[model samples]
Target: MPRLFTGLEISAQTGLMLSLLRGGLRGARWIDPENYHITLRFIGDVDDPTADEIADALARIRRDAVEIRVNGLGSFGNGKPHAVWARVEPNRALMELQGEQERILQRLRLPAERRKYIPHVTLARCRSATNQDVARWLSEHGGFQAPAFTAARFVLFSSRSSVGGGPYLVEEAYPLSVAGGLGDDFNADAFAGHDFG
Candidate 1:
């Protein structure tokens, strides 16, 4: 069985931009730039045939590409720390996509997700952090927001571990045609968070 999930591949350019953000955090275990993505659903480990079925189901998804603005910065823990992530601004388009994908996965008979949907891109994993450190980091990086970018397609990815990192790979892409074809990948250099003025 292979680990599987659906995600939006952050283009090479976006990956670079995200990498730069990670550079600021001294304690951050910066995720490899190549593995950066916005995951829609995690399908866990499954057989090849189920993976194919998942791809087929996802290809039937009919929705145009959406505009996603990456904004805000936050960590996900209190007391004993766990992880840190970049949060996305909530909007109808994002909510709809999340709900739609959730429903699709449920129809496939997967277990119901325990938590409510909150869209975000995980940036770093924190083993632990002191109260003072967390406060300082938040204050220094407050108001962190990435410029809006378009999400053109949803992908079914096969994740596996390697020496560099473990369990993240793209297997197939199911595009959502909006206007013409998918929009070009946003340039990281253009949106590089420099000065943030």
Candidate 2:
């Protein structure tokens, strides 16, 4: 069995910027900068057959590369502040890709994701941090923003069954195309600037 999910990898430059927020707050277990990614669908522990089915199904999704921006900071767990994250600015392409992944998993008999999709790159896991601590951290770092980058691919990642901050391994990658495929929206201008030698 493998615990798997699909996500978009961030640029190292973006991850390095996010890494700067690691200290100051107590009880924060910072995720390694290399592990920073925006999760699309979390497909929990699955049999090898199911995993293969998921990998095959995902390869069929073809969307244009999405521009991702980390525009702000936030946390979950209400008063307890269990986690902090660098929020991803949501746009149509990103939402569609995530929704496609969710639908694929559900069609394979995986449970539907109950939470509304909120795209974010988790920064830290809060262990003993209180509401005040998280609030203070957010106040100081709330204006943080990373230079936007276009994601060329989404990946299937495997992880050990443990706490969320991961030592994830990429199992497979699927590229997004500028040239329209199947149901993808066509952009004729995508070819305009290219030098086809």
Candidate 3:
């Protein structure tokens, strides 16, 4: 079995900027810069056959590349702060891509996501941080922004069954094209030389 998700890996430059936002907040377990990503759909633990089906289905997606921008910082929690993240600027292309993924997963008989999709690159996990602590941290780094970058592809990432963030493995990748077709050069192994960190 593998815990899977489809996501856009952050550029190294953007990851570096996000890494700087670490610390100050107590009980914050900062995620490694290499693990920063905007998740499209989280496909929880699945059998190997199901995972293969997911990969094959995802390979058929032909959406164009998306221009991603990291804008502002926010926390997710009802009362006690649970996590801090860098917000992904809203864009039609990004939404369409995620929506398509949602439909595909549901068609495969997977359960729908309970929470509304909010694009964000999680920066830290807050275990015992309070509302006051989160509010103060947000006040200090709320203006955080990163240069816009084009996401040429999305990847299928596998992570260990653990508590917090990654050591994620890029299992496969699918290129995005304006022409709505996979190019002949599309290689699943093309992620080899790239550094997600």
RMSD of each: 8.0, 7.5, 4.5
Report the C-alpha lDDT of model 2 over 89-196, residue by residue, as the tens digit: 999999999998888888999999999999999999999998998999999999999998878778888899975779998887777764444212223333222111
Q: Which residue pairs collide in model 3, if any? A: none
Which structure among the candidates has the greatest TM-score?
A: 3
The C-alpha TM-scores of every prediction are: 0.83, 0.89, 0.91
C-alpha lDDT of residue 158 in model 2? 85
User: How accurate locally, in lDDT, is each candidate?
Assistant: 0.68, 0.84, 0.87
Model 3 misplacement above 4 A: 178-197
Candidates in descending lDDT order: 3, 2, 1
Q: Which pairs clash in model 1?
A: 160-167, 161-166, 161-167
lDDT of 2: 0.84
- When summed lDDT is taken over every stretch of 10 residues in candidate 1, the lowest stretch is 188-197
lDDT for 186 (candidate 3): 46
Clashes of each: 3, 0, 0
| Model 2 steric clash pairs | none
